[model samples]
Target: MTRKEQTRLQVLNGVLEHQVTVDEAAQVLGLSERHLWRILAAYRKEGAAALAHGNRGRRPANAIPLGLRDRVVALTQKRYQGINHTHLTELLAEREGVVLSRPTVRRILVRAGLTSPRHRRPPQHRCRRQRMPQEGMLLQLDGSHHLWLEDRGPWLTLLLAVDDATGTAPYALFQDQEDTRGYLSLLQGVIERRGVPMAVYTDGHAVFQSRRAGRDETNRGGATQWSRALGELGVTQILAHSPEAKGRVERANGTFQDRLVSELRLAGASTLAEANQVLGDFLPRFNQRFGVPAAQPESAYRPMDSELDLGSVLCIKELRRVAKDNTVQYHGRSLQLFPSMERTSYAGARVEVQERLDGRLLVRHREQILTPQEAPALAADLRAQVAEGPVVVARPDPDPTDWNPPQRVKTPVIPGPLAGDSIWYEDPARKQVHRDLVLAGMERARYQGKRIGRPRVSERPEFEQQFTVVVERIGRGGLSRRQAARELGIGYATLKRLLDSQEKSCTKPATSLSLKPDTGEDY
Candidate 1:
């Protein structure tokens, strides 16, 4: 009998002998006197055997069969290789029609000495920061580039946002890459659905923060397009120093990588659109299952102002100067800004050119939207064709010579008769002063050891005398060109050049032998 049964039997024996009262035995066994009386009756008739539990030696009613457990282990080792225990449990229920909890499946595998493909890391102590008291106070934004469609489709990046307060995903989408435009669209969706968040927590991705590789953190440098968009919407952006700093989104990425990939595979989502559809269906359930209510009921998210347009706020914005032809060139495309009611032309005006999420180019000046037609190919020539006003031929000053072009001639320095009405002569005093200033500037530059002009061609190198002696030796048949090159610490080409130059300077006969017959090939 089990120790618990043996103790109960001893207490009942004491009660029967009158040494232990009914109340005392009941208290010892932690049972009511009515139940104790029933136990006493059974023990008096059946002896110590009645103390054992009735179902102690019987198998549980819901016990899994050996065949099913073996099948699961075989699948884990073969078909479902590399699948985690938790994911395998779900797949078993959905596909294999073998319903089981993760721990039950894990138990079967552990008994079979089979382990999960991925191992859990030992938990480390970390000081987790408390979540924001209200939703929309802080939302973690991140993008994960992973094999969402496995081998069936191209790799895609999933842009995700998780609320710090509720641990719920507000909006997520798939993109070809993690780009400035993708994050902007993500923020736009979140804002439209749940209102504008007070702030965002993100990593130091180039989309979120301006690159300052060699600069100090104290120097923020400048706002990136994403940061600028947030600023325009009055949303504060907090850059995380490490993954743990933004653990909410980082851990969400890991969970999606594990579960979402399996979901996409199970749904047979082979295309981006199909994957997104599956994702859309999955997120609501995910939020419902995992989301918790915030500590406070009131939402921290500020209501979007009716006047503030999300399309204008959440997009890539750049300062573009309107070309003289009233156009803004962006990414090899010309955005032609037409005249607004207040202005006749945007030419020479610095305007904000926004590439909206819908791929529309918006040019705004002083918050006024300017719509312009897409100038066709060779737009510059087209603008030149459409003149703003009348074509006026620039003519000379209104006079007798207005019909004739004025002729210009220079007067002689010696006061000759070459001067004309439109002619002008150089001033001698001004020229002298300029000359003096230039000379003084050159002297100052020379004193500062700054080179004044193109490097002077060396008339003669300092070692020319020594090189000349070596060349003469080679010419006199005393030293070979190779020998002379090594002795003078110069190359064979240099020695040969010296020999040729010496022959020309001294008018001496050539004494060096021709090294090789010309191949007659152009170098």
Candidate 2:
């Protein structure tokens, strides 16, 4: 019996035995005198059983039938095995016509042990930075490498930017890899659609900064290519020293890995373009579901500067000095700058060559775009075409009788006993005699100090082989040189020197592990 039922039985017994007054029973039970009287009368006739609820063991008239419940569970196990309870509920309503709320589905699945809450590690205690007061105040940017298309296609990288204040993803695109051009395309999309953010938070990749370990801070003060582009647009770039510092974007990447991958699979997206098209349709629904309102209703984003040229601001720019003939060299292509009205000649002047995102080149002089033509190659180089230009010399015919060459002399040898009258035939005894004679001569020459042939790697000291193993292991495992040296019983400085030499000897990169800047397509 419930505690309420037991309490009522006690109250009625107290009143019937005259141990407690009727007024006291009513006050204790928080019921009126008249209501308590009715209950006491029923209790006296019906006994303790009357205190129980009348509908306790009965199903309601509106309850779903047993067959429907069984079908729902069976369908979940068969067709939508991995679907979560909430998504399954929607699918059941739409496809199976079994209307149910998420909580009801969750309770049914939990009873069957088909689903359970996810287990997560306890969060570390750290002071969290508060979100900005307004949207667009700070934007966290990152790229996630994931198998977004599942097995239908190759792995792709999703470049995204999330507004820190509102938790809204303003820009995201599917690309072949995480590269400068991809970031540029993302930046352009954001600027054209959502306006300029006040500041961007990112990690210290080579695309954002120079990553020279031994160089002083002052030496790396000059802006990188991407940084310079951002500076030209008046956007502040904030570099994060650790992953925890950029927690917003990092968490977004994790969430995308979970939700976006499933969405792409459901959409049957098999290529980058197909994934992007699906993403375009998915972002709006996602933002609507996950975006939070900022403290202030007003947005913090500023309007783009009218004079800014996005084409010039979002490209690879390199400074080249013009030669006396008005030629500038860039990536082995010589571009001849034409004279404009502002200047008679650009000879000996430094000009900027911009490689636009669309793979077009533009030469800019004093903030002015110039027409560039391919320069004619010089005559001194044989690689330059000379068929239509000039002939250096005339061909002369040679007389065969006038050409005298050196005469050859032949020496004859008498055939040996096993010669078989063939030049290739040789006796085994004679070969063995020649080998013994060479060995004897070498033994005699040893006293005079002589060595031949290259040394074998295995012949080196044992310590050197260990050093090589430790170095290669460190490179693969990403261990520090000091830690590796300590474990291998070697000096730290010696191991460091060996690593430096190995890096110098490697013309190509050992692995795609370093945060190097990527120069490729924007899409």
Candidate 3:
């Protein structure tokens, strides 16, 4: 039995024993005397059994069936375990055929050991303030930084403006950081969507508020660039003392960080584009649940001014007229601005020259936006003539046959079987032999072009072969390997191997007839 019923039984017991008066028992238990007397009578008639209420055995008429309760719990555990009971309940009815209240889902979850863990914290202090009656009367603008893409990407700053009355987010955009450009672009979007609001509430960001000066102490009489733009459109800008002062957007940021992050995660929004697409559908549902009604029945937003030039107001530089000579000077460059159509004259005339944020030039005079026109052929020719400097001509070279190469002299060679052996010849004409023999001797002489005298005989292969054997013996006999290898162009090991192989072959004995050395006279 519940504590209340137990206490009622105890009060009845006190009344039955006559230990306390009915009025006293009733007063002690905070109940009517008649109610206490009724409890006492039921206890006297049915003993302790009557102390139980009649409704104890009665089942609730609208109670869900056990099977249905089990099914709902199973569905929640299987498909929506981590989802909140309220959202789960909605999903249950929508996705499945289960119709259950949020409280019923919560009860089922609790009984099934699925209650959400509660965090312990001290009591929070809250401030109470009334919002404006009309939706467009006040807009709270701020930026929130979060890991909007989970682990998929870097953190992004969300620049959002929420209506103070309806809590409706009319403008939201993702940026790399909260900067002046972000707010300027955000304001432009808000203006385009909902027209001009009555007033805007924001923190003291330099974009909306003057840092060096207060709202009433700016260079142009307390007006910032954004403030000036708003003033030009007759919109009021209210600067908040702190983040809490503009509590609407601040609180909205908190809600979005929690609910929106989950929403984005569930929708598989890994990029800014995907998040924006999902946000379009999520904002309406979120506003319906948390938003309050506006105080005024109608909106207070004003129509945008017709003659207001949006680009010029948003951009940093002021518009100026383009000078003649088809040129509009800015910063340092002398920009040449030409008219597309055939105009008789543009001298001493007003032409709007828009200096863009990225330092680009756009000239607009009257209602038409002027463009450059191509110069005529005659004008181009005149410009070329008036320009300075003389032209130089480059011609091709004369015929190749006109040039002659240097002459070269022929040399003669020695004769005999030794012709094959590379030998140096002193006078080639004197050593001339049979044409074929001379050719063969010429090959042996190893005639290298353009030498003053005969090349050293030691350069010949026959000289190197005999010199190598002698050098190897000299090395083992006394001299260093470097002296021996240098004469043969072979390393120490190669010379040593040659000597070893010669000794091995000599000891192996002669298998063929030995020939006598040539005794022919020198050629």
Best by lDDT: 1
Q: What value of lDDT does candidate 2 attain over all alpha carbons?
A: 0.76
Sort the predicted structures by lDDT, highest score first. Answer: 1, 2, 3
TM-score of each: 0.60, 0.59, 0.50
Task: List lDDT for all candidates, in order.
Answer: 0.78, 0.76, 0.68
List residue ranges in candidate 3 displaced over 4 A.
1-83, 110-127, 212-224, 311-336, 339-523
Residue-by-residue lDDT tens digits, candidate 1, 140-221: 9999989888889999999999999999999999999999999988988898899999999999888877676436332235
Q: Which residue pairs does candidate 1 place in steric collision?
A: none
Model 2, position 159: C-alpha lDDT score: 93
What are the per-residue Cα lDDT tens digits for candidate 3 across 1-523?
Answer: 7787788788777777888888999898887878777777888898877877788888899888999988987876775655667767776886787887888888988999887433335978977788888989999999998888778766888899999988888878877889766777787777888888998898887788776664342236555667766777677888899787888899889778766776776677887778777777877777787888888879887777788776665554334555556555555455555545756556666665554444455666677666543333345455444332223233233222322322223333332233354323443322332333435444544544433334434344465445546654785786666677666444566555555655666654222212222222221
lDDT by residue (tens digit), candidate 2, 284-303: 87688789899998998888
Worst 10 residues of 3 by lDDT: 513-522
Residue-pair clashes per prediction, in order, are 0, 0, 4
Residue 377 in candidate 1 has what lDDT?
Answer: 65
Better of 2 and 3 by TM-score: 2
* Every model: Cα RMSD to truth: 20.0, 22.6, 21.3
